[model samples]
Structures are given as structure tokens and as C-alpha cells.
Target: MKQDVDSAKAVMRELFAPTPLQHNLFLSDKYGARIFLKREDLSPVRSYKIRGAFNFFRKALAADDPAERFVCASAGNHAQGFAFVCRHFKKPGVVFMPVTTPPQKIDKTKAFGGDFIDVRLHGDIFDECYAAAKAHSKETGALMVPPFDHPDIIEGQATVAAEILDQLPGDANPDLFIIPVGGGGLSAGMTGYLGGRIGNESFVFCEPEGAPSLKESLTAGKRIKLDQVDNFVDGAAVAEIGSRNFDALKSFAADQVMLIAENAVCVTISELLNVEGVVLEPAGALAIAALEEMDRQSIAGKTVIVIVSGGNFDFERLPDVKERAMRHSGLKKYFILRMAQRPGALRDFLNMLGPEDDIARFEYLKKSARNFGSVLIGIETKRPENFDALTGAFDDAGLRYEDITDNEVLASLII
Candidate 1:
């Protein structure tokens, strides 16, 4: 395993130099601890996925049939990485992506592979695309390069850990390492390598709350598929944990894994973007979000390394990201209010709002009653606590209302 990791590191250098390991002052001051960010986002493909893709292609090309073709299913960073490797090796490859994949990613993949790859828009969901890729590989005798399950892929991904240990100062072995989990390639690789190197270092695994595949698999003591997964965090929203990756990580303590809410993660993404000028995808913000859930005292003076997984964020989703961040931060809220139908009723409700409150949205839901009407209102405030004051004013004015800010079902349908 050590030799494989070392070889991966050496091979990676041939493609691109090592990713930077710079100390993060913003995070260090915020957490009152030394924080170093492993900028895997700065990789050639702007993600760490290229390492596994290159390694898979390298090994397959050296096999008995060096001329064999390659195929894979992905919609985001993986597709770009596979396309990059295909062009680098001058091998014919096919990539299957969901029909709903963004145009930006499709174009980027095409640009990377140039004439070396064919892109196929298969089904509406990833499962459909994956199935198509497998069928094509089996029928054409081409190699199927899995996104995160194979031994070579794991070994290649482990090279990130090797680089971190080699790059850090001799006295700076991180006491805590925070890793983000998707299909578990990065997390499994880092944990496997670091577990062997340092006998006592701690590792915290972060996954999107909407797609808790690793948490579910760990609880069940085996790999399990979720019936439904929210794909808002597209990069890390995997429905099932990889079987091979699970085998490597299942032995870790269940409590070591931390699941973060998708909306909460959006807040971190926005903060990093605005404050540090760092653009991170949803999965990229996982390790940073995990820091908020840790015991501050335990890591107060300790050295910590947080892996910034990828920077494949699409600017088109900026509005949705901001919306989620506002909701998570409690600065924005949606409510259904029943108000008196008199001409002064609207004025009365407006007066009830605190000085810090602002009305972002207002619409009439129903006006059936002669003396009463229902209104859908969206409010934004300078601080979350302002909502409490506004609600108290509502109580004093006898305004009937229901706060649906955290009601997923109602908010999904009405908001």
C-alpha cells in the first residue's frame, strides 16, 4: 500500500506539480487554531478527480491490451478528469452523462478531450447514465473506469495524503484532519494512508446531510443504497457508498463522521467566496462546515488540515446558493399570515415589523372572507434575532400566522 501510494505521488508529478498547502488565516483566526487548507481545487482539472482518472487509464494502457478503449459515467468533475486523461493518453473514450447535466460542464469535458472522446447524453438520472456506460463497455470490450471504487483509483487518490505529509513542516503533523466524503474515494484514500502513517492522528469525515450514504452504511455495517438523494450538492450527492471504499472506511468509529445540512453548507460556500475570495463547490465546503461541529477546546491549539475538495461551482446556481444560505442563516423567512381585510390592515402589519426587518416578498394567497384574508409574506432582517422581536409585535397586535421557514414540505410547495 505504501509503495502504491508513493508510486502514485511520483506519477502525479508527471501530470502536474503538487497542489499547494497554504495556512488559512481566516479559518485559523475564526477557530482559534492553526488551519491549513489542502488546495486540491487548484489541480489541473480544478479538482482531485484527475488523479484517479489518470491512474486508472495509466494502468489499463499498460495491460495486455493497451489499445483497449475506456468509458465512464459522470456529469461534473469526474467527466472533466476522464476527458483530460483520455486526451493525455491519446486513447479513445466515451463519457455518459445525464441529459440534465449543465451545458458548461458538457462543453468543458468536450474541450478537455478534444478528438479523443465521445460524449453521450444518456438518461435523466445518474443511474441511467451509469447503466449505459456499463453496457457499452461490456458490449465493446472497453474498460469501465469507475469513479471511486477500484484499487488503483483508491491508491491514486491516496497520493493527496502522501503529498500533505511531505509538504507540511517536519514538526507540523496535523493533529486533526477533516475530509469530505462523496463516493468515498478521497476520504477512504486519505484515511487509509494517514491511518498507516500516524498511529494516533484524528480524522473527521464530512458528508452532505441530504446524501448520508456513508453514515447510513456505517450504521448498517455494510453498504446501503438510499431510495432518494437530494442532488442539490451535485458534486457530493451520491445515493450509495462505494463498496470497495466502504471496506476501507467501515472500521472507523461511527461518531467520527459528521453530516452537514446542504443549506448550512451553502453559507460556508458564500462566506469563503466573499471573505477569502475562494470559490468552492458544495462538496468543497464540507470540511470547513465540519469545523463548526467540532469540540473547539480539543482543537484550540492543535494543527488541523481541511481538504478543499473541488472548485467546479457553476455561477448559474449563485441565486439558489444565496437563497439557501439566507434561509440557513435565519436572515430570511417565509410565513403565511391571516390578516384583517380592512384598508388599514396592511399598514398595521407593516407597522408590526421591527426596525431591522424588511419585506422581500408579499403576495395575497386568498381573499375569500369578508373581514379576513390570507397573505404569503417573505421577510429579511439584519439579524436572526430580529425575527423574534417582529413575532412578539405580531403577538401583541393579534396577528395570526404560521412560520414555515423550516417546514420542508410546506416550503417546497408554497415558498
Candidate 2:
């Protein structure tokens, strides 16, 4: 396995340089640990997916005819990587993406593959798109490249660990490694190599909270498929762990994996962007978010490594990211209020708010009767405690309101 990874690394160097490993000062002081980040976000395709795609294509070509066509299904990083691989080898390839996939990703994939690829917008989500791609592959006799779940893909991704060991300074083995899991190719590959080289060094896996497939599967002693998955963390939102990946990872206990909330991940992305001028997609910041959830005392003096998975973030989504971060930090909230229909009702409510509080949204939902009206309001404040005072003032003024911040159903419908 190690030799195969070394050979993959050699092939990678012929195409692009290995990503950098650098120490993070801000995170180190916050946790009192030496933290390093393996910046796979800096790869030519802005993700580690290209490594797997290129390896699969190379190996497949070597085993057959170079004239064979390739096909894959993805709506995120994998699509772009596969497209770039097709361009690199000058082979014709077909990429299937969800019809609802963002235009930015679609454009980038088209830009990467240029004339070497054909893209089709199928179903509404990845599973549907994947099914369609499989059907197409069968009909046309084109080779199907899975996102993860194959031995070749795992071997290709192991090159990341090989590079990390080669890139680190002399005798500076990290005591802990924080890796992010999506389809599990990257984590599976790295864990296999590091288990032998570092022998018993601590490893922590990070996943989107809404889709804890790997964690649940490990706990159940077998593969477990999630009935529903939240797609907010698009890159890391997978319904099930790949069989091959689970085999490589099954040795670890369930507690070793940590789930990060979608909103909290948004906070990490915002902080890294505002503080360090570093832009990371949600899945890319998973390893960093895990740092905040760790038992800090246990890692006080140890060396830590976090993998930054990708940076292909769309700037157009910045406003939504900021909103999620604010909500997670308790700096913003939404409410439903019953107020008198008179003109002075809004003014009275405004006067009850604390000095630091500002109204971010105010909309008249409807009038329940001739005298009372329903209103949707969003507020922003400097601190969470200000809300305690503001709500107190609301009670003192006899204002009727419901805090809908944590009510997902109500919030989803109105906010």
C-alpha cells in the first residue's frame, strides 16, 4: 500500500506540487497546542479529489485502451476534479450533476475540462444524478468513476499522507491528526499510512452533524445508511460511508469521530476569512472546527495537524454564511410578535430594545383582526445578554412575542 502511494505521489509531482504544511499561530495560542494545517485547499483543483480522479484515470487507462471514455457523477469538488483529469489526459468524459447544483460549480467544471468533457444536468440531488450517470455509462460502455468506494481511489488519496510525512520537519511527528470525512476517501487513505508510521498516534475524524454516517456505522458494528441527510454542508454530506473506507477505518472506536454543526462550520469559515484572509469551503474548515470541540486539557502541549480540505468557495454565498455564523454565535435571532395594528406599535417596540440592539428585519406578516397584527422581526445585538434585557423590556411593555430562533419548522417557513 505504501509503495503504491509512493508511486502515486511520483505521478502527482509530474502534474502538480504537493500542498503546503504550515503552522497556525492564532489556533495554537487559543488551544495552547502547536497546530499545523495541511492545505489541500491549495491544490490546482482546490481540493484533494483530483488526486483520486487522476489516479483512477491513469490506472484505468494503463489497464485498457487510452481511447476509452470516462464518466462520473458529482455536484461538488469531485465534478471539478474529474473534469480537470479528463483535460489532463485529453480523454473524452461525461459529468452528471444535479439540476439544482449552483451555477458557479457548473461553470468551474466546464472551465476545467474545456472541450474534453460533456456535462449533463440530471435529477435534483446527487443520488438521483448518480443513478442517471450509471445508466448512461451502461448504455454507452464508458468507464464509471466513483466519487469514493474503490481501492484505486483510496490508494490515490493515500498520496496525501505520504507527502505530509515527507514535508514535515525532521523528527516533528504530530501527536494528533484532525481529519475531515465526506465520502471517506481522504481519511481512509491517510489513516492507513499513518497507523503504521506513527503507530498509535491519536486521530480525530470530523463530519457534518446532520450526516454522521461513519460515526453511526462504527457504533453499530456495520455499515448504516441515513434515511435523510442535510445538504447544507454539501461537500461532506454523504448518506453512507463507503464499504472500502469503512474497512480501513472500522478499527477506531465511535468516540473518535466528532460531528460539527452546519452553523458552527459557517463560523469557522467566516473567522478564517476575516482574520487570516484564508478562504475555505465548509467541508474544508471541518478539521479546524474540531479543534473547538476537543478536550483542550488533553491536547495542551501536544503537536496537532488539521487538514484544510478545499477552498473552492463561492463569494456569492458570503451573505448566507454570515447570517448562519451570526445565528450560531447568538448575535442574531428571529421572532414572531403580536402587536397592535396602530402606527405607534412599532415605535413602542423599538423603544423597548436595548441601545446595542438593532433591527435586522421587520415585516408585517398579516393582521389577525382589526386591532392586532402578526409581524416577523429579526434582531442583531453586540452580546447575547442584551437579549435578556430586551425581552424583559418587552414583557414590561406587555408586548406579545414568540422566540422562534430554535424552532426549525417555524423558522424554516418564515425566516
Give the winner by TM-score: 1
Q: Per-residue lDDT of 260-377 in model 2, one digit per residue for the tens?
A: 9999999999999999999999999888998988889989988898999999999998998999899989999898899998888878888888889999999889955689988899
Which residue pairs in candidate 2 have backbone atoms (N, alpha carbon, C) closer than 3 angstroms, thus clashing? Answer: none
The digit string of per-residue lDDT tens for model 1 on 1-415 reads 8888888789878789999998999999999899999998999898999999998888887878674698999999999999999999888999999999989999999999999989999999888999999999989988898999988898888889999988898878688888998899988888888886665338888888998899899888989899899888788899998989999999877777898999988999999999999999898888898888788898898899999989989999999899889999999999899988888888888888888889988988886789888899999998999998988988888889999989999888877
Which residue runs does candidate 1 get wrong by more than 4 Å? Answer: none
lDDT of each: 0.89, 0.90
lDDT score, candidate 1, position 277: 97
Candidate 1: pairs in clash: none
The count of residue-pair clashes in candidate 1 stands at: 0
Query: Weakest 10 consecutive residues, lDDT, candidate 2?
Result: 192-201
Off by over 4 Å in 2: 64-67, 199-201
lDDT of 1: 0.89
